[model samples]
Target: MKNKIPNKIHIIGSVGSGKTTLARELSSMLNVPFYELDNVVWKRHEGHEDIRRTEKEREEYLNTLISSNTWIVEGVHNEEWVSNSFLNAELIIFLDINYSVRTYRIIRRFLLQKLRLEKSNYNPTLKIFFKMFKWNRYFEEVGKPNFFKKFGDYDDKLLVVTNKKELENYFT
Candidate 1:
């Protein structure tokens, strides 16, 4: 089936679910700027310290992006703090790939980042790698369900993709 995606899109998914990759592709294809929630949430001012932005700051920043006519916002964040983006988005894409596939991607991405074969927003270390796996598990068990429940009201605008092929088909 052919789908007409909107310019204002919000992509939500668990870690390693290809949210970033999809966001980048969509941004290029649609010629719209994309923002990663992680960057807006965490600020590494100096070294490895993750200084989180205040709720007001994040809201202001997000408001600025949303004020634009077209944009793509992607991240794993599903908290109330980010509800504005969801509300403002014309479409919400959820990458609901299988746990096994996500796990494999996580490991592969970690290795690539560690080897400097891939660029990452944060430092690639054993600690962060292990944390990713843990986060993945938590997401699969808890976050995914919570997202469904919380965003159920937006089902009409939500597009759930369970595999790469399905996502490619939708985009095509």
Candidate 2:
């Protein structure tokens, strides 16, 4: 169990921004529970359309973790709706890795998924492809503002980790 101080941690980034990778690493480093928002957003089910139906359900699940004293949550959702997690988090790490880096990672992830024929609840279509591109662009444009709004200028509770070396240094 995590103590009250620094118990809650949140990570924000685009797809393939290494959010989960860093979260898992931090969980081991800090000895705290790590919660992937993807898992919370979609309940695993056998060919069920309703499995990932409601944002409300996802929000509720997150609320449960926020109520707890210790948790590290990672996802690429809007900062507005997900503010509660950050509000509780003693630290918030945003991975602002270069667009090329994230693009490479996403492409690699796609290839691996295709090779394994893995069944993911999330969309793996061209729509998602464009979405990923748009997300990367938004990170530079729209997303940065929200990030700053929630975790920067007004707040000093955020850490922006842009490269593997920076991440390593922070965790080390």
Candidate 3:
């Protein structure tokens, strides 16, 4: 059977897993709008400090996005607040990239952001840079296994991808 592209896709992974990049590509290929889960959690204003959204507001915002006809949501968050996205998605892509690759990406991304070669929602400071490593490791140990345990019920439609090439087959 020919693979059919999904209208509502949920992409999840640790930091530097290329969730944003893949989401953007898929959004273009699928002709759908994409949103970052981080955006839902924080209110961003260019050249100003970002404000964290209230829990209720974040839920409401996320709900609005999921309620749309078509969307691609990518994020590193794996919590009760985001469980609805998993339930609502037509396809769930868990990016299980190599730890070493993620580590390299984390460093590269921070450098790009610092050099202003790339734009960031938040200021790239030394503190956040350190936290990215911590978060990446946490996701590997606690977050990775927790995802399977919690969201494994959706395995029928879930696609665990370790490499970006794997996605090309599905999209093409």
Which candidate ranks first by TM-score, i.e. highest?
Answer: 3
Which portions of model 2 show Cα errors greater than 4 Å? 1-5, 53-55, 117-123
TM-score of each: 0.93, 0.82, 0.97
Model 3 worst lDDT window (10 residues): 163-172
lDDT score for residue 13 of model 1 = 91
| Prediction 2 TM-score vs. true | 0.82
Query: TM-score: which is higher, 1 or 2?
Result: 1
Per-residue lDDT tens digits for candidate 2, residues 27-134, read: 897788998887877787655553673877777888988888778999887545577887778888888888888889877877766676654556566677678777
- Global lDDT of each candidate: 0.89, 0.76, 0.94
Q: List the residue pairs that clash in candidate 2.
A: none
**Per-residue C-alpha lDDT of model 3 across residues 98-152, encoded as one tens digit per residue:** 9999999999999999999998889999999999999999999999999999999
Off by over 4 Å in 1: 46-48
- Global Cα lDDT for candidate 1: 0.89
Predicted structure 3, TM vs. truth: 0.97
